[model samples]
Target: MAEPLSSLSLWPIGNCQVSALIDDAAGLVWGCVPRVDGDPTFCALLGGERQDEGVWRLRLAGQVSATSQYRRNTPMLVTRLEAEDGSAVDVIDFCPRYQHSGRMYRPVAFIRIIRPVAGNPRLEMLLTPMHHYGTEAARTTRGTNHKRFLIGDHQLRLTTDAPIGYIDEGRSFRVEQDLHFFLGPDEPFTGNVAHSIRAMEEATELYWQSWVRGLATPMDWQEAVIRAAITLKLCQHEETGAIVAALTTSIPEAPHSERNWDYRYCWIRDAYYTVQALNRLGALDVLEKYLAYLRNIVDRAAGGHIQPLYSVMGFAELEESVAANLAGYRGMGPVRIGNAAWTQIQHDAYGQIVLPTVQGFFDQRLFRMADERDFESLESVGEVAWKMHDQPDAGLWEFRTRQLVHTYSAVMSWAACDRLGNVAERIGRPERASFWKDRAAKIRARIEAEAWSDEKQHFGAAFGHHHLDASLLQMVELRFIRADDPRFQSTFAAIEMALRRGEHMLRYDSEDDFGQPETAFNICTFWLIEALHMCGRSDEARGLFETMLAHRTASGLLSEDLDFESGELWGNFPQTYSLVGIINCAGLLSRSWDTVR
Candidate 1:
């Protein structure tokens, strides 16, 4: 079977509402319909004999070869396949997303425009949209120009310019003029489908290019930063501003490793880093939208309690279960649906929630600046951090079987109170500032006293164990400890000693529920890259960052995990965390703007 997730070289196109991963052959192999979290309408990415259930394939009757590329700087993908008879078809796949009306018209749709590129090409279209994780295919009925598919409570209409009989009967026909298909809601398509798609393509290209133009790129590594930034933006759900961790789930970290888990939900820690990275590029549009998402989350948590992750729609309950109907990535079993980590007590989220929102209180350029009430609402988060700083829960790792009083969690908790105090002072609330300042100081004292390992001369993963983790690098980021501090330096060296694998870095060297990790977590390598720069290893850091850049996919994307030994990407596709790493490292290590002259 194909390693559908990483193999076949999948390219993704999304409108922030729906996303699809297509194979180089122009097959709609992996995509969820209606929404990113919805049931798989194209589930062939995860292996199964059920290709007729959740996949769309466009092929020439005698097709022998294919190649793919994205349109210049835009997410539009073009795949050309040449048949043995010297005939070819170019498949253009994109999700229609441009400003429609006064608001963004990101309807749930996948648009494909196919054109004959060579002599007498014959095209065959197999659109098998499945429901309930590919357990069954939907019932289809047809009109003169459209086919309506009924899947559970949803109705999908596939409007096209081709002969309806040819599509319904799977008949191969001679290629003629341009053919367009729009698979979305069951409503009637208003105008000429082909003309509308052509217009949407032009508008979509303009939208992406214009968005790219606003990015504040560094003098060096301009292309890498742009691609990474664009991928990160695609992770955001435009309807609600919640950014997902990745577009996929169940892509294992290593071969047959059940480390395969769902990454379709929003993790507070991941979103904070994403915003921080985009904020450096002056993409306050993302940060500002995310701040609103953060505020919604905080408001929904009327009490002090909060989850480490939530659905893209901001729902809290995400019960995890194995999808028995489908095989996992590369035929790995037990593909998972919802993430269980949402219930884990990752205390670091408190800091992350406050960290991004605090920027709004100070940044004047934002249209909707945060006010006094926002700061007060944020204090409630600080109080939770103050209460939970020393308590034991799942660390950022989300260990399925164990819990520990993680040093990283305590420091982040301290950061929460620390930022709260800063925001309070900025808003002229001296008394509130004093209160949070005192709390932050006390939390810092506890972290300093308990998390330190005198024998090892470094901080540990937890209060007792001297095991070093790459997460400790955030000590400098959270400002809990200065980078030059001997303790932090020792910790950095210690983590590198244990977790560094040649040019790559692992989250840790220890065993978890799935046994020891065989692949380097891609984001951890970037953390090491940033740490090296801060520690005055600028040349080594630059060399390492460039090496990591070489590992990106053909489309200039990264996954959650990397097999350093083999130089193969693993885990979920187009991981936002990995993309954030690229943006952050490029910004940190780029040559000074003054030297550009």
Candidate 2:
């Protein structure tokens, strides 16, 4: 049995906490538990050193093959096996979530193990736990039985009443036959499969089914789109509403190109889109949780300014440190920890936060004068945007090389002012309304005058440069300009000519004279799809949408970028923003088609 490079071959069936994939030929079950940051516990995508942090592998014999699916909407995964010897086995896995009593909480994370019917098929199990992001080794000890190991400040307890056999390694263990593993901070690990496994299987089936039934999606792309949404929801930090950019880090931006970047932290820009997508799906509970996170950002910033990204726990000032000791995935050098884009004046971030905040107030009717807390949140965001209106920013791409007065940044700055004006008027805040409206108008005039290039007759990447950028696709998506506007057409043409790579597009080409061009960004491509829809190119837009969908991996996963020449995914696997953008863009394009038809 061998591992297939295609993700489509891996079956996906799990809840927000963990998604399990089964390899039929290998008879191996793989699962990913969303971490506080973006990385997964089982990182088979990264390979070698980045293979997996915590693993549970079971080997089945007798020429057995497997098939699996989720137990409804619950996190429970069920894999069925049939062997040549006419034996069958049902393997179920699930982590009991914090959702109960109509609320979700953290800690006491539970992973239930169940085997409904053992077909007397021989199976071998292996469990491994790596510490400090797979950088350090740990010690293992046992109290006469159960496999117990401690790493750093945490202890893992593996308990199974099954006839468990063990093979000892220095830091890990290889278990045989029927056994179970549990990991946590303090709880003594225990699992009695004989009785508990059956109960767990039934309970898990009911849980997921109930969850799926509660969803209110419009039912257009229910299967693939909802699955993508569920995957994004799972990537969220349960303790905090902060969502990560992806579940794995250091999967090179280009194959062997030294372009890998850590995408674990919460990006303010990503959160804005996430709110829109979730709100449209009627997932108000999740939306409000994220709004609470946003309010926390405003309270902490206090008009000083907010970082573009933050830790899962809302910690700002992400230090871009590297883990020098650990061997990187497939020898990709200098694995990064924190993001340096936090402090830069990516002025587009201002609009990212403000636009969604305004949308919340308007669309959801979330703000009221009587609610002091809501007013405070709006005021905090408005005041910050007003203060930073004139400052230079790094722009939408968050270019690592230099800071420039990016045209996209100006567009967002103007948007922030525009949204504040609208929200203030709605809430009868005259003072704020008048000031923001005037500010927005002035910013708009300046953007048209300064960001445009007379020589090229198109929008420039920044205030002075001649280069174009796909970020301007947002100009139409955000309603900054109408689809029929001649200026938009010219700008779109320039961007298509310059940034488009094959069927996809990029943020902007580098300012330098040297080095090869990188792959087209996945998010920007969707931005183009939306722009096309708005421009009255519905047919073209739908064609592009299908083209983009074709790029999805075998398991319906997308990366941050794609190699233009080779058609291989570059950057992290299953990028959250990319998938979310696809869903949103597809929805918009479909609606446009319906309207035109």
- Highest TM-score: give the candidate number: 1
lDDT of each: 0.87, 0.63
lDDT of 2 by residue, 1-597 (tens): 233332323444444444444443322233333344532334343334433334445545553577766554543556765668755556665554545567643332334353435456655555555555555545677654456666556565655564434434322232234344344334554455445544544655665566556665543555656666666776667567777787556667765576667777788887777767766666665666676677778778846477888887899878877656444555665567677778777667778777766656655444321243565566666666666665677666676667777777788778888887887787788897888889888888877888787789887877777877787777776777887888888988888888887778887776432246578888888888887777778788888888878887654657788777777777765678787876787578554335544
Q: After superposition, how far is residue 391 of candidate 2 from its true place, in Å?
A: 3.3
lDDT of 2 at 573: 52
lDDT of 2 at 293: 76
List all candidate RMSDs to the true structure. 1.8, 4.3
Report the C-alpha lDDT of model 1 over 259-338, residue by residue, as the tens digit.
88899988999999998999888888888788888889999995767799999889999999988888767687678999
Model 2, residue 122: what's the lDDT?
A: 57
**What lDDT, from 0 to 1, does candidate 1 have?**
0.87
